[model samples]
Target: MAAAMESGELSEVCYPQDNTSCRAPKQPPGQAMVIYFLLSSISLITTALNLFVIFTISYFRQLHTPTNLLLLSLSVSDLLVGVFLMPVEIIYIEVCWLLGDVACTLYYVADYIITSASVANMVLISVDRYMAICKPLSYLYYITNKTVHVVVSLSWLCSMAYRLLLLHDHLRKPGRSNSCIGECVVVISKMAGIVDLVFTFVLPILVILVLYVNVFVAAMTQVRRMHSHVDAIQSLRMVKKRELKAARTLGIVVAVFLICFCPYYSPTVAGKETLVDAATAAFEIWLTHFNSCLNPIIYALFYPWFRKCIKLIVTLQIFKPGSRDAKII
Candidate 1:
């Protein structure tokens, strides 16, 4: 029995020499290999897709509208998720936290900041669509490029500050929640969890829902007006149609964001303290990151300009002179 116990300890421990080391979860070799392959593929694809989005919007002068600027900010955050967070998470699934507690804390800090910024960008997109649809006459004046730049900057700054405060305990004492070496975990108290839920998830989602409801109603009204007034000016009808289409596309993005994020925060809603670890929270973490990959695909499906940009990018035609001025829309 003693020999068997020794064998088990040797096999299960993250470090056999360190008796206090964390136990590693057991999995078949084949299964572990397959899981690693699938996760690596997702990380690579996410990085590549967001890169395409970032470049597409930035390179094309015609695509420099306020709405695309918001998308650009979102893609940047998603790109960070793909480049940094996903890879770290993939490693965390099967390996010990070798980079030490400081790195672990910093990794999560970056994760939260990027995630908060992404949510903020989504809210801004909803606002932009709301103005364009519900108050079209003043949209051009209110949602200009300069205004968008200022708002995007403020969102990022606020996200960073907010996350720093929320995770201050972890920052002050790295690895405070770890029970053993080789483990990285964070424990959020009930109070902090509730605050995070209310500020990050509940309020943003409520705002998005309310604005979209109004936007939808106003869009339907405009559609009815266009149909009823057959003598409406052709240009005016076309503009309204374009605005309605943009709202529909952006609404899909917001809906997907909600679906991906809801399960992650459901624990707080259920009156549980938020405990984050690689093993238990893996599904929620990956689901949130997966949204980054889906956004570019969504754009490719709904925006002809995105498909055209992809073609030009693949064919190397973007390098040609005056490609920026090409009629993509």
Candidate 2:
């Protein structure tokens, strides 16, 4: 028995009758159950939290603003990650790709589109906060709800187009990258990987960092100026404080996103082609998806409005008439 195991004779094939099928990894039954429970828990929590965020912003009229609109777009993308991407990944953790090659290709296409949309939404949020902080005078003029709506629509459209183009090869020839019958893999060439890294990760992160730095400086300057104006209008002071606090909260969201995604792109950063195979890239893939779970948690911790919204949601208060007009912020 020991010799058979060592000689690969005891290895499990994804398809017992198919000689060319991929070998399934050996996982203890007890360990598999534990992993399934943990991953399923993450998926449930992520879906529930992002749903709250979506409902809070969408249902409350008072929460409808350019910034909240950007957040709403973000929540939608994160919700998709929780609902769709994470569950698929959990399946990949312990199973062969039995869904066929075309399905595998389509799955990755959706994954890329959702991820790109999430990053685009983060960029939009940073731009919104920067305008509110550094360009306050013209913020309302430039960052209206209509404008945000258009921008968010364009972001999603662009994400779809970009991902489709990026994965055109895979779309053209499903299973081209897979080495075995039951394997689902996408091998990105070095050049394509570099381009993806630059647009999706490097450029967006740099823009976010630069915008937040300017926002931080401007916020500090405004705080000092308001303090020196001992007779500043009370309402004006309150508005400034609110904007500053928002910037800080969104900064945390961006920071957490960066932390979660950096490791996933580390191979690309090191000049390697990005090979995305569920069997081999489980840790990095799950880490990035975990960001979806963290975003709503950050909001719940930092935003009082979110906590209030949660209370209303849990107690079924949102179904009440006039709840839409309730003060959320």
Candidate 3:
């Protein structure tokens, strides 16, 4: 065993002098290569996909509706997750964190803020769809661009505040809970885990589900009354069609969000303390981040506008003059 350890083939310690220091996991040659490749590929794909969303919505003048603005906010968060968080996470797999405890705490801070904001954006989208479908007449007056901007700003601000409070102790005393040197870890109490699960997961999901059900009912009713008005029938029908389509598309988005987020928060929901560690963090974090990549795909599947935008973007037609003025809707 001593000979094998001396050979440097089994485990590698960060500090040779301190036998109690954390040892980096020994990854088999092939497994390490494959894992690294997969992680790098995911990071690239997530960045590209969310970037496409951000550019498409930001560039197109016609796409500057209240709904797309909320999507723009979401895409921004997803893009940051891919660009900043995923690369660090990939490096964290086999390597010990060289960054000090303060950096580690800040890293998790960024993660929580981004993740919470993404969830809040989903809630906003669901509410938007609900208002459009269920209260069509008042939708324009209530869900204006100004209001949407305010909501998005508040969502981000609240997420940051909530995360700061949740991680207050960790921020105050970095690495106070570490078991060994060179290991990055944060421990949230079971009570805090429960609170996070409720506020971040349960309440938001409830709101989304309830609002979506009402939206569905209203959409079906609108479909039935399509021929009721004779004077403004065509205009009303056109608006209703748009709203219904948006509801369906965003319903898919909500479904995807729930599927991705549930597994990540499962451990917390199980009445256990949430341990942010290398062992089980990757599966949950990557699974959640993968939803960012999937969102654009969901849009492509359901929104014709997204498909058109992709065509223009990929063909470099977006750079041509008057591309922004192109009719997308």
Better of 2 and 3 by lDDT: 2
Which candidate has the top score in TM-score? 1
Candidate 3 wrongly placed segments (more than 4 Å):
1-11, 227-232
Name the candidate, 1 or 3, with the larger lDDT value: 1
Per-residue accuracy of model 2 over 47-122 as CA lDDT, tens digit each:
9999989988999999999999999999999999999999988888788889999999999999999999999999
Model 3 C-alpha lDDT versus the unseen true structure: 0.88
What is the Cα-based TM-score of model 3?
0.94
**Residue lDDT tens for model 3, 28-143:** 98999999999899899989989989889999999999999999999999899899988988888889878978998899889999999999999999999988888766987888
Residue 169, candidate 2: how far off, in angstroms? 0.9
User: How well does candidate 2 score on lDDT at residue 90?
Assistant: 85
lDDT on C-alpha atoms for all candidate structures: 0.91, 0.90, 0.88
Encode model 1's per-residue lDDT on 1-329: one tens digit a residue.
99999898787878889978998866589998998999999999989999999999999999999999999999999999999999998888988888889998998899999999999999999999999989887997788999999999999999999999999999999999889988988888889999999999999999999999999899888878788777756678888788778888988998999899998898898899887878889999899999998988899899888999999989999889999988887
Q: Candidate 2 at 57: error in angstroms?
A: 0.8
> Which candidate order results from sorting by TM-score in descending order?
1, 2, 3
What stretches of model 1 exceed 4 Å from their correct place? 1-8
